[model samples]
Target: MWKNEAEPSLLEILRKITELKLFPLPEYLSIITKRSNEEFEEDDSEDERDNLIDAWDEALKSSFKQLEKYADYISDNSSFGTHQGVKGLEFLRVMVILDDEEARGFLFSYEKLFGAKVLT
Candidate 1:
């Protein structure tokens, strides 16, 4: 989908998330631990700014497995991946093909990188 359609779709997902009233990361993980009857270490730190904490705060608030499935869907369906969209993803190997002439967006340009175009 184009930017016009994608933005509204994402906003709708966020709205649904708010309506779900899902438990916070720690609380949800604790519940899972109890359900699985598995011993787990408790994090004593209360730092909210931690990266892992922030990731769980955004993506995994409702379910641990949802993000993987969502990422797979995006990988299979989307034509291009943005930096924000691919956050927290890991891959063993990646190959990028760049042709600045055909680039549709102005987010990045190889001309600047190669000293052919100077910044204003």
Candidate 2:
């Protein structure tokens, strides 16, 4: 997912593009947030699973319709996702977003990764 602060900028960019009228607006645009492990574990009941499954099904249908409308754009543009989300996937190019929160993680030390001291 894009950083929370970057969401506004992304929306503005989308708004500008839509105003240009180069393409039709999608019938649906859903942003599904990645659930934390703790949250997922908490919803372990069968009823909760069923509800989540139904929601996912609806989302998938909407996504397919959107893809049909903008197949070219989808194919050309790079997908933005968290590291865990892109596991086992391969792409010609990938840009990793390492903000302050991610920088402090044990898996990726900013200083070690970039060979520069982290100011924080």
Candidate 3:
């Protein structure tokens, strides 16, 4: 879904999650946590109010799984940054160039090609 876009929004990612049914929303009425006060009392009933905290946890797990499952597709040798934009995906891969000279040559080549500006 993020193949061509510049940078997809969080809502767009969430929509993709639903479309893919990657992790899926919970099957219960999400709790609405609140600070109890003299005038305010906690009430539990049938309502799906996550207030983001719950939603955040769910989103992270889902997002991480998506990154991990699709790491190969999301990363490349030349450009670590995926144009498809896997938001919140960090440490996508670990690589050993295995040759200091090769690594230096690569940097010099990329600097000449891309003018020292790291591709984002």
User: What is the per-residue lDDT of model 1 for residues 1-120, given as tens digits with 9 covering 90 to 100?
Assistant: 235543233223443444465543345433333332132123434645456544533443333233433455347653334453333457755554445787666776544432335645
Which candidate, 2 or 3, would have the higher TM-score against the true structure? 2
Clashing pairs in 1: none
TM-score of each: 0.23, 0.24, 0.23
- lDDT against the true structure, per candidate, is 0.43, 0.42, 0.39
Candidate that scores best on lDDT: 1
What's model 1's lDDT at 83?
52
Model 3 C-alpha RMSD to native: 13.7
Per-residue lDDT of 86-119 in model 3, one digit per residue for the tens?
Answer: 2444665544323334453443332222222344
| Angstrom error at residue 52, model 3 | 4.6
| Span of ten consecutive residues with least summed lDDT in model 3 | 31-40
Clashes of each: 0, 0, 0
Off by over 4 Å in 3: 27-120
Can you write out model 2's per-residue Cα lDDT over 6-113, one digit (the tens) per residue? 323323434445657656545332222233336445655566346554464343433322433344333544232235544445776665555646544455443333
TM-score of candidate 2 to 2 decimals: 0.24
